[model samples]
Target: MAFVGREQELAELAEALQRAAEGEMGRVVLAGSAGIGISSLLDELESRLADVPGIIVARGHATEPRSALPYAVLAEALGDALASLTDEPFKAVVGSAAHDLAALLPAISPRLDALGIGREAPALEAAEQIGSRVAESLRGTLE
Candidate 1:
């Protein structure tokens, strides 16, 4: 369906995309009740940005069963990117930090190992430490 009547929302999304294209961090969140047009808006956004260079649009869905998993959606969204890090250049860019992600994202373990990155000792003492490690590892992956 043709998009209609979301001028303000589209404008905001465009500005955010432009900033990201210029190497600035941009984030957007769309929240609403079911059946509201969130999906449609995202589809429109994807179509609009189809030709923008160096812009990757990764998407992930949170299902009922996986919703309880920590960083489930994040792991899904970054799955392809992480998989691509198996090559030497990308692995070097990620460095040993990629191994830390294995604790949270099992799918990355083999790639991390191939890079000769060893895992850090598990942070069993506190939940906060685990969360911090996960966040740091994710940041490293994104960088």
Candidate 2:
């Protein structure tokens, strides 16, 4: 189906992106009842942002055989983009919690290793437990 009018939605997203670029933080959730072409809208928005600088677009899609958690769908979608997230100028942005992140995302282990970090990265209390340190690590990386 052809991508039709959603100029207002697109503009809102664009404005949000601009605000983020100017160092304003915000969370975006595009949602509605099923079969409302959310995927196409996201694709279009992503395409529009393809050339925008200081922007890192990570997409999360919800599809069949979904998870029980309400946010799991989007989380699952964004999870796949984790590698890309870590691959960005991570070393440059990450701060004191480098080892914590190394534990969280092993893909970054080698980079951390080269920097002489995480040789003895602290062990998480549990794999399922994500402490505030890791969250701050990510905020720093994304900022």
Candidate 3:
């Protein structure tokens, strides 16, 4: 079901997408608390874009609590990028990022290891530093 109050927002998103299709770069930032429909809006936008030609969508979600794990979100977003790699050099660079992250956060490391990243050196940092770096990494990955 659609949120009854967000008709204008959806229309504006559609307009921005139309402009982007014509070679314009448009960005939207929705700032609000959880359950305020930001994710839903983003989901709607992505769903609308799915049928458009030449469109690629990469999404990352990092909550404050889960954001402490280094590169937790980047690794998720990069999975598709990593999968698209057939070349050795690009694969090495991106693969190393994935591997290093897995080793850094023990909770996530085993899961990533299951995905084939193995034997990586730990990314040593304090808890606060890890959180800060993870947020930074997420922002960088989005760009």
Best by lDDT: 1
> What lDDT does each candidate get?
0.70, 0.63, 0.56
Worst 10 residues of 1 by lDDT: 54-63
RMSD of 1: 3.5
Clashing pairs in 1: none
- Runs in model 2 deviating more than 4 A are 61-82, 85-88, 114-130
lDDT of 3 by residue, 1-143 (tens): 55567789889877866786787665554566778887887787777777776554545566665745545555555555444434453335435455344444345454455556555544756767655654554344333
> What's the CA RMSD for each of the models?
3.5, 4.6, 6.5
Q: Pick the candidate with the highest TM-score.
A: 1
| Model 2 lDDT-worst window of ten | 70-79
Model 3: CA > 4 A from native: 65-143
Q: Give residue 1's error in model 1 in angstroms.
A: 4.3
TM-score of each predicted structure versus truth = 0.69, 0.64, 0.44
lDDT of 2 by residue, 1-143 (tens): 46678888888988888788788988677877788878788888877778866465666555565544434454444344444545345545555667655555556667666666544555578875555656665566555
